[model samples]
Target: MSLFAAETRIVRDQAGRSVRVPANPRRVVALAPSVTEIVFALKQESRLVGATQFSDYPPEADRLPKVGSYIRLDLEKITALGPDLCIAVKDGNPVDVVSRLEMLNIPVYAVDPRSLDTVMAAILSIGDLLNAAEAASSMVADMKGRVSRIRQLASGAKERPGVFFQIGVSPIVSVGTPTFLHELIESAGGRNLAAGDTPYPRFSREQVLALAPEILIITSMARGELFQKVKEEWMGWRELPAVRNRRVHILDSDVLDRPGPRMADGLAQLFDIIHPDLAGKY
Candidate 1:
């Protein structure tokens, strides 16, 4: 396939916008961490000349030219990169930024992978756009296989423990039914106590106590004193089942927060934490 082929294909992005992209783009930029991860997963990172500051996965991505962040993109820097293609995420990358890129005649492919299935689809779509269909398909298949094995193992579990996933400590933020984290919790054979229509809901201490989650998984993005403090505060709820049973767990936010390839690892970790008996089975 010629990189400068006179061929173009129209595709619908995650934001439901139609875009015409090059048949084989030589220069690309990603505006979100998840998008950058997908590009690396497809082994097409060589074409990625620019990325957001938060695109720190794969380690090498950190060395790329910084294009500001998802919320605030450096238009001049991105323009100077002369990218034929730009990847964005519907949830993280703002619509105005994507619009600005499009106004500058840069093709933008936005993706929204809010669920496991959608995440796999987003990888495949990106692969198709980058002309790495085979690699993308293989990666998606591997991810699906891992998730299926976990599902099989979880199916045999006699009980599904009630789980409370803590994302923030101050306002007590948690994942709700509309988010991928909720799906991950269910896939790991745990019932999310914060399941609701809201994507990220703030819960009160009294509400959490009433819900009575058997397991408390804290995704402390920070480390050291802050992480210790969050756990210490939860420890004060001695009457809670998770605290009483010593099932409070502090997990890495990178794996849990980013909707990318590492999500499979996060799911596996959740399974292990929630059901220790099924450890090493999947």
Candidate 2:
């Protein structure tokens, strides 16, 4: 027998659950966009037999058969694909769905990349599962190098702006300390004005006005027209420092919202926004 002939191995997922998965998962299904992205990063996209509807990055992902959304998965379709393994994300995939898949004897590997460090770990773990350790290590090294450079640049900044990231306008939802966005904000030398234990917190207009953030960031999946509309609403808040100084910015939700390989790009964008003067320099 080969040195590592075991066809299946026991691995602990991010949720601290022991799962027996194929040592080399050739037929894989990604239950979340982030998970799909990681597989693509590992150069194992050909192994993906199925993926969620939101797994549209890398362009090639959109061509794959979609099992359904992360929350409302099509178990039948997923099973029909005859995948040897299914990769899910902690926050993206519903717990009940994972349980259902498990009951059906599908090997589910759950990953949670809530923070920057954990994000790197998730990539490494996925690589390990897919038997793409070298690719995963290379990807991680590149990511670390990029992040280290950003941190080195950010450390010398004299002042960190107070940034307010707006997720929703109607209910006024904002990112808190528990989410990756909050960590990205801090890492890019900006302070998240929304202070709460909740990953995403709702704040009243009065509360936001009180914080008086020096910078405003808006997240949107829509393009020019919708972005213009959202920007117009914030324009009315003339008293806000961001409004007065025109520091308000709009970012594509895909970059910041999805925790994946593109996170380095997201961090760079945040760094540029927080410290515009140090843009080309970095």
lDDT score at residue 82, model 2, on the 0-100 scale = 87
TM per candidate comes to: 0.95, 0.94
Residue 146 displacement (Å), model 2: 1.5
- Which residue pairs in model 2 clash with each other? none
lDDT of 2 by residue, 1-282 (tens): 343534788999998999999877778999989888999988899899999987888899999999989888988999999888999988868888788889988899999898888999999999999889999999999999988888889889999999999987678889989888998998898989985798889988898889999999998655567777888888899999999999999998888888888998999999999999998465
- After superposition, the stretches of candidate 2 with alpha carbons farther than 4 Å from their true spots are 1-6, 221-224
Worst 10 residues of 2 by lDDT: 1-10
Global fold similarity of model 1 (TM-score): 0.95
Query: Mind giving the per-residue lDDT tens digits that candidate 1 earns over 1-282?
Result: 564665788999777989999888888999888889999989999889999987888999999999998878888999999999998888867778778889999999988888999898899999999999999999989999999999999988999999999998878999999999999999999999999999989999998888888999998656668877888998999999999999999998889878888899999999999999898788
- Number of the top lDDT candidate: 1
